[model samples]
Every structure is written in C-alpha cells, then in structure tokens.
Target: MAYDVQSAKTWSPGDNAFYLIVEGTTQEEIKEYWEQLITDGEILQPLAPSQWSPLYGMLKHQFGVVWALSVLNDASPM
Candidate 1:
C-alpha cells in the first residue's frame, strides 16, 4: 500500500519533517479543516482548546510529532 503524507491546516512539510501551523485569519477555517482530517482518520489526535489557546491549537496528526496553530491577531511579522 502506498503511504499518503498529508497535512492538516496547521501542518506543512519542511525541515525534512512534517509540521503543523494554524495561524492567519482562518482559525475557524483551520478548525473545520482539522475536523475533516479527523473524520478522514488522517489525524489521530483530538484538538483541545488548551492545546494552543482559546483562539487556536497545535498538534501532529497520526504521529504525535508536533504542530502549531493559533489565531492571527497580528500580521506585522510577516
């Protein structure tokens, strides 16, 4: 079987590893995306409000690797 390497809203492929970052003005969008990922069995972790903040959360899907997600209050850094 072929392994599928997918990423949740917060996850991305970089640094030779999979990382998740849920930021920007799309917290709700990201949450919905994550919900879909869970429903699809792509993610094995439940997202908790405390995982990151009331505004966001971070988690690794299927591997407990690590990911970051949160509300984007400021964009000056970018």
Candidate 2:
C-alpha cells in the first residue's frame, strides 16, 4: 500500500512518521482513540486479547494513515 505517499503529504517524520502506534496506559484511553480514528476508517484488525498485551488492534484511517493501538499494562512492556 502507498500509505506513506497518501497521508498528509506535507507531514514528515518530524510530524508523525506516517504511521501511528499509540500505546495508552489504560484500555479506556486506547479505546477512546480507536473509536475516534475509526469513524471513517477501516479496522484492519479487530481489538482483542493478544499475547503481547491485554488488548491490541490495527486500523487505517480514512485518509490512509495506519494506526496500531493497544493498552500498556504492567504485564506488557512495549
């Protein structure tokens, strides 16, 4: 996919690196961000329990920005 070429053309690594991997301290926080970004986007991966974290998911924004969201709990270290 040409995500790097599709999202905010003016944006640079200094801005967002084109791909966002948000690690929230709480499930609610990540979920909040997920719900908002996914409004007009696509859910590449549904949110669910993963070996790496309590919750994890992947999605692409309407404009082509890819997002990886998850909860950063004590049990996980990423």
Candidate 3:
C-alpha cells in the first residue's frame, strides 16, 4: 500500500509514513529479509519481540521506501 506523505503532517518522504509489511513464518525468515533491506538504508527500529509478534521491526529501504517486517507468530492474530 501507499500514502501521500504531504497530506500527513506527522510524516514526510523517507519516513515511516508508509510501511510495506512482509510477514514470514519464522523469525529467521523475517530477520534475513530485514538484513537485506537495511543495506545502505536505515533502521527505524531493531528487530525484536513485540506484543503483536515474536519478531518485529521497521526500516527504510535503500530506495527510500519503508518496511515493517515481522514473524507470523502465535501472538499475532493474522
């Protein structure tokens, strides 16, 4: 999905205004993808356990896109 960062006063380009979530079945799967995205980019939040999932993190890709990666764990509803 996408968003118009200009319309959101709290967000701007290169920020976590829009997140492309990529959920995996295992923490290793998520972590691997997270590592690939962080290259030449920035990490908004380090991968770690969260209330919603076993492993979760947010990061900006090298191409200025944001992403939210997580492991599909029991804690998560979907």
Top of the candidates by lDDT: 3
Please write out the lDDT profile of model 1 over residues 1-78, one tens digit for every residue.
112245544434552155456554665776775664444244334455543344555445444445555555544233
lDDT per residue as tens, model 3, 49-68: 88888899988889888888
Sort every candidate by lDDT, greatest first.
3, 2, 1
Error of 3 at 13 (Å): 4.9
Q: Whole-model lDDT, candidate 2?
A: 0.79
Distance from true position, residue 72, model 1, in Å?
A: 0.4
Model 3 ranges off by over 4 Å: 1-9, 13-17
Error of 2 at 37 (Å): 0.2
Question: Using alpha carbons, what is the TM-score of model 1?
Answer: 0.42
Colliding residue pairs in candidate 3: none
Error of 1 at 66 (Å): 2.4
TM-score of each: 0.42, 0.71, 0.78
